[model samples]
Target: MAFNNARIDAVPTLCASCEGRKKGICSALDCEQLVELAKASRKSTAESGATLLGETEGIDRYANILSGVVKLTKTLPDGRQQIVGLQFALDFLGRPYCSESPLNAEAATEVVLCSFTREAFERMMQESPALERRLYRQALDELDEARDWMVTLGRKTATEKIASLLLLFARHAEPPEKTGRHFARFELPLSRADMADFLGLTIETVSRQLTRLRNEKIITIENNRLVIVSDLRRLKARAGNS
Candidate 1:
């Protein structure tokens, strides 16, 4: 707690190096405010397959994803789960003022999060209009992404859908290590089954489409998980995206 009793121009130590502070809504706050909020914050990690929030789970805290991917899933009464969306690094993890989570949020990869009490977060939102507006903008961005996904589901062919899914991960997924090349490289975070569920395709169809992409040289698969998007322009073209 070096910054505890003594005040300086710096943010709290815990938040000084947080990705959320640089890229998320926390960027809207100044040093003093970050210090105040940091008092209520804690950093934690979850392995892949860990559930961060469940449907009907009471809202106790809000978090900013520090790293890795989180999938938001909606379950039907018949016991089917659909991956509705994904949260990447620096994405905010809770809905302000919501009493409970309506969907289940689970880690799609090993994840790091910086979480703070709901009251503290809400209080800060009230005090910092910038932070509040930032969150609102993020919500709107998610809505826009969802609308785009609707087009993919309703109009795209199976190959286009597979390409779209791969491009989706390419846009958000950060590989465990950097390859430092001209083209985009990422590890497919979801399994074939989960990807099938996300894209409304059968497991066999997903696999077949992936094989097609590999044969076309648009992408290279190392093992079953690591994917290197060799030609992003071609990949984007295949996905029917700009």
Candidate 2:
């Protein structure tokens, strides 16, 4: 996709409220520091399924999700691929001290990101102990999530795998109360091929399993998006969770 060259300030966002809201890293930062960091950030957009950075790419900048989701994927020599991480709004990007990226950071959907040069961002982090501490916590949390996904992909049944993924989407999504039952409605950010890579299944299997879920009244699919009519507890049971 051709990228638009809009200025950073021209990008739309509510700086102060965003810094104080749920699912936002800014909420954890002091106002003065947040203001300082904001001044250094630049905004960019990526279309759905765009590769923002590849494994072979040198790390030049650090980024944070201003909106939409990103997928961190690794490919094996034999062509096998796995999505190791999913980054949502207010999530960090680029390993702090790394010179080269180990995986591809792709936009799972049309996304807006706030970026900073790697060297400057790292130096700033060093000068700001509170920011550095928060980043450390973020890394640990991401590692824990990676481990959890590994377990799901390795041991879960196809149905359970899909259910777990759906539940996670629900957990990260905006308020359900505002949209009524339609709150469960949202597009799958990644394609079935990407889903297969993440779930350790073939694309055909993923498609079939999704159909089976709908056939069993577990979910409904329309235009490739899913709607979960059942409560989360039921979905978790389908996920084989105790």
Candidate 3:
């Protein structure tokens, strides 16, 4: 009975059953603080392809993604765009203390956000050192991911890039098993064009690499979206992680 109660505590009554609360920065707050924060938050949803924040958009709020995927793009004035990053459930979105967004954030799939005014969040951070520490750690994690992805984009081959993208989605689908020996399934958040853009490959290169992986018995594609990774060990090995 005690273990069951502890399990139930994952969904404390102070807020909706958001994974963000369990794994996100909200975990830094106690129940009373959660209630206070809730008073200033509003739940909102964005459809796929909706722009959550545009480049240079005035930043007024911060959000914790509750579900689905958000893609970040870096763009040029000439209309060229590169998909720079992706965010998933329980990830914090938006830059606090910044007046403008440096990248465009768009929904790659339907998304839910628990968002509150930046003023309210800043006040909470000032009052709670724990929250400030949590935000700092989240920012550090983002920096590390960005560095790793830079290697993937700059050094990985076409096949390696495709496998790396699939491996990323697989890890996001569930905590990656040791050596990734376990199977995983997830529908891709981005289309072929978006994947190409994100991986710095052409659409034809992405498609050809996917075909190679399929023929090699590493993964299977269905309905042009659903992906089942069977050979995760091989897939990870091919992802060029050394």
TM-score per candidate, chains pooled:
0.93, 0.84, 0.90
Q: Runs in model 2 with CA error above 4 Å?
A: 1-14, 19-23, 78-80, 176-183
Error of 3 at 79 (Å): 2.1
True lDDT of residue 85, candidate 2: 79
RMSD of each: 2.4, 6.5, 5.5
Candidate 2 structure quality by residue, lDDT tens digits, 124-161: 78777867887888888988988888789889999889
Clashes of each: 0, 0, 0
lDDT of each: 0.90, 0.75, 0.87
Q: Which candidate tops lDDT?
A: 1
lDDT of 1 by residue, 1-242 (tens): 55555655877889877777888989999888898898999999999999999999999999999989999999999998899998899999987899999889999999999999999999999999998889999999999999999999999999999999888888776544655444787788899998999989999999999999999999999989989886678999999987
Error of 3 at 167 (Å): 0.6
lDDT for each residue of candidate 3 in 126-236, tens digit (9 for 90 to 100):
999999999999889989989999888888899999999999998888544463547888898999999998988899999999999999989999998989887678889
Looking at candidate 3, what is the lDDT of residue 114?
89
